[model samples]
Target: MNSPLPPLEAPTQSAMPEAMNPSPDRVYIGFDLGGTKMMAAVFDAEFNILSRRRRKTRGNEGQKAGLERIGETIDLALEEAKVTHDRLAAIGVGCPGPLDLDKGIIFDAPNLGWKNVAIREFLEKRYNSPARIANDVDAGVYGEYSFGAGKGARCVLGVFPGTGIGGGCVYEGKIIRGTKSSCMEIGHVQVLRDGPRCGCGLRGCVEGVASRLAISAAAAAAVYRGQAPKLAALVGTDLKEIRSSALAEAIKEGDTVIEEIIKDACKHIGVAVGAVIHLLSPDVIVLGGGLVEAMPKLFVGEVKDAARKNVMDTYRDTFKVVAAKLGDDATALGAAAWAVASLQPA
Candidate 1:
């Protein structure tokens, strides 16, 4: 379920000082389009957040309505920021699912039931501003690379384990990508030959064994077998009730089995990270998403250990595994920053 939206308010005094703030006309919009919810944020050229608005995606409402809702969300944000559309410099969006990046279209979002979504064209036509789109995970990793956990690193890898697992990489300040699509699909990498089927129809993929949904399923079974009494008491055997925070609470209440389940999942993720290490050798690997947010210490510690353990000794200490710092704002901020960066003259 999506979290409640923050109450709308005017730009705070924490905004950049007048001297450093960009010209009134130099504002940007960054939108995060997720499966459950979507958010729109306005930022100054310096990237200080000005205002934000959030809304449920309501994917069942269909594509036309969903597009309308996205526009409305952006309008509300621009209104709250007291910045008119005329002042907007450009717009950037971080979107989920397979994308035709060169064409700025989301090719498919199984969760949202959206396909061939011409998000960039919609934004540009609606606001009469230049627009760009990228994979949401790529935007998030870029956000961390630019200002959060992976700051100052030469290469940063981000792996987010949520309903499914998502991965992104930033090397030398540029988000690494294929010629026409986003790459670094770590979750789709096979970990167990002929293991359980993943949502992607692939057997033994990392996401099949290690995503939050996968973990929740495993924990729910423990609840059914009467192993996770604390979790059972808190949320019963319903898979929908086994949220990330709830799992964390169960572990806190001495549910050692539940903790073990999480560790095992993180270990799978680490195995994937170890493979990436052999290829990119990133300076930092950032673990983000609700699962990591709810149990940062355990996830980071276990993944770190497992990753180090699986890799060659010579490659040990070559990378640091860390948690994301920007929380929910990472995608929006990163999308906006990417807009500015991508638009710069070569």
Candidate 2:
């Protein structure tokens, strides 16, 4: 199989031609829709962010509010960039899913409190521009493949640990949307049966053990049980204050209890990643999101060791585990790349 293209640098203003005489390929807008926030960016063909805006999703306000938020963010971005609708080629959205990608309808996203929302139609109607929507993680993987760490790799797997765990994959320059779009739900993969219940109602899933939510919950439990001294002090009688970051800090301070918790969390993540490596044999596994950022040494080191130990010898040396290069902007850039790719002849 051919290797993937090299990661493109984020385009700068100088990279975009100053002459704004709307070419056939004009600016593309990318939207990353998350449960709490929505980010919109306008990018030229070279993937330079001309303007970007972010707003709260206000999910409790429901779908109407979310759509309005998305529209408002896009409008703000366009206004900031002084770009008109006529100058836009298309809009690409990276949204939470269990979606009908072909139909552009989001089936359900627990974080967004959305169900069966026609996102593409909403964007097209509001912006009067062609629009496309995809799973946010999928967009992240595509973004990484096009302009981040996964560039030049034959297969790339993106693992993100935020409020929840999520993953996306790219194989041979294409996003791998498996049958029914059920492919790459890495967070839900079971690492240990009967260990702990996840939001998805599964026991011992990766999300249950390795996500930020999980880590925070574990910290709270430890504080409640009087097992973590630093966490208890930081919480100061408020268990809710024992968050993932505080726990990570405690580990950095060499707190034995926090170290044990970190080890356990890393072990679960490692096992889940090991399974993914053995199953997909991706050229690179890119890790990102809040948990990894908070505890880079723990997540990266443990996952790499577990994956190497678990995989067969023939495949052991072929895969590399690395950090996601794009950080938070990955999904947005991916949306822009998706728009660009869609416009090209299939």
Candidate 3:
């Protein structure tokens, strides 16, 4: 569970000892492969970012093309860093879907229409370096534990609400996971029986009720009902236009109904966190993703209060809820750090 990289003050940089630095021939690659976009970053031994390349995922192009694009992105990132292929030491990837951890295969990425993709094998064969794969949420949580909001905590449970909700835990500096697959599927936890149907075809899952997509749907309905005039003027009833920033803006413009919808969603998230507290006894709970980043104060405050109210009184004071600091870079950084840790001699 030991981390190879030293603790970092996220969004900032500090010099590391010369003895700790890797030789010129050693470098690392970290890739965040998201549904809509993908990013590849090259890092020095100390985990300082050397260069980056980004591009649209265009997942509809199919898995073969997508994997090729991933390879191309990494090549460009290394090119920008002025590092040769022979200098690469390891590669790390954060991907969405149900993954076979041992085999490093993505069983399914619904958003990408990809199934049974051997991402690890591809990276290893293409670059001739060790490659590690992790669920995107797990990588993000580990990133926070290593360098961001969850720093100094014994256990950190990270919850991110975007198009859907995702949860991951880092304990004693390692991601808490099953032997062959990822765990901590907090979003799928049933909260309200017979409520909304989730994308997973489950009823009353927290994601169906509390995710940004859910919130946007509700906000769009409100706009149609003339219940959120401020929001209607900003984005109308178009779900695609109702982004996190737009929702925050609607609330800022005196849209009480919109605020109420967000508050309700946070309450649902808090309810889930309360259950997690009883199970894991984590010392810190981190709220991250687009929605939380857009409204940190409201998400933190509401979820904190609701969580405290739901947990047993003895558990109420045991944890603190905080907003994530790393933003979009969390998954990539965590994946890179994980690769470094995994590569160390036993």
Candidate 4:
């Protein structure tokens, strides 16, 4: 059950600034925006990170403060790299959705506490450079496809199971931008009808079942009831300290309770991924994010089996599920790719 939000206004496309010329000597800047932290990097055409900076997002201070921090991070990265704006080819940003890609406007990002903020506009003004905005997962897919594991794949699906379950797809070489940029909201896809409530108020969403938040919540409940011994021992009195890695570690140690929880979560994730395989039949499926990276044996293998079991035999035999190669830098590198692609004339 997807929550209903007010209609978002279309983004206004700004003409590409003349300064965004193709120059091998120029550097590009990329920013990855999150609820708690923001990271910026300066890179050359070859994708070498010349400099990087990070800052607390300060999302509670509202959109203005978040944007300010993002600007500061970009500035600091450029300053550290000793590059002037003239040497910058473009700036790319990867942020949480739902976004209006055409207008470079973000409609609503629950994690960032932003609604209808013109992020690209703000970035362009702040840095005096041509800027482009994309959903974080989409940017990551682009990053991987352009330079990482999914390179040369005809169709690639990137799934990240983090604080929330989010995904993005690249069909052939282009990012799949659905109607109003709503394509690939994989997290909100309903896996169970009338099931667990999601942060977006939806029931039985993929994220509601398989996200780190959901897993952590379940762990907390189990701890409250004294169901998990090893996990409790590892985290002490605070259930909040029991992260996905800790849970994975407990499962690795063969703790029955933690194993069961992980199995349940994996089943949900597998089912959801199975749906993706059935529908898209992508050539490559990249599973990433903190949980998948930490518990590869558990999460990745389980999802592969579940998808193979549930998907059509023809599709199952054709698609390959693998871990993302870029890991945490996917967003940043993808943003750089977006900037390069967007700035180049078609």
lDDT (Cα, tens digit) per residue for candidate 3, span 1-346 = 8767886756422121112225665788899999999999998877888998999999999999999999999999999999998778778899999899756799999999999999988888888777889999999998899889999799999999998899999988788999888999999988898988899899999999999999999999999999999999999999999999999999999999999999999999989999999998899999999999899999999999999988998999999999999988899989988877766765
Model 4 score (lDDT): 0.82
The C-alpha RMSD in Å for every predicted model, in order, reads 11.0, 8.3, 8.2, 7.5
In terms of TM-score, how similar is model 4 to the real structure? 0.90
The C-alpha TM-scores of every prediction are 0.91, 0.88, 0.91, 0.90
Instruction: Note the Cα lDDT for every prediction shown.
Output: 0.90, 0.80, 0.90, 0.82
lDDT tens digits, residue span 1-346, model 2: 8999899987554322223324855788999998888899998867788998988888889898778878889999999999887787778899886888766788998877888898888876776667778789999989999999899799999988877788898888888885554368889989888868888897889888877777777777776777777777766435456566787777776667777766777677777777877777898988888767777777778888877877778877888888888888999999778766765666
lDDT of 2: 0.80
Clashing pairs in 2: none
Model 1 lowest lDDT segment of ten: 13-22
Tens-place lDDT per residue, model 1, 238-283, is 9999999999999999899999999999889999999999999999
Q: Tens-digit lDDT track for model 4 on 9-94?
A: 87555554644756777898988998788899999868899998988888889998778878888889989999887788788889
Q: Rank the candidate models, highest lDDT first.
A: 1, 3, 4, 2
**lDDT score, residue 222, model 1?**
96
Q: Record all residue pairs in model 4 with backbone atoms less than 3 Å apart, i.e. clashing.
A: 11-103, 12-103
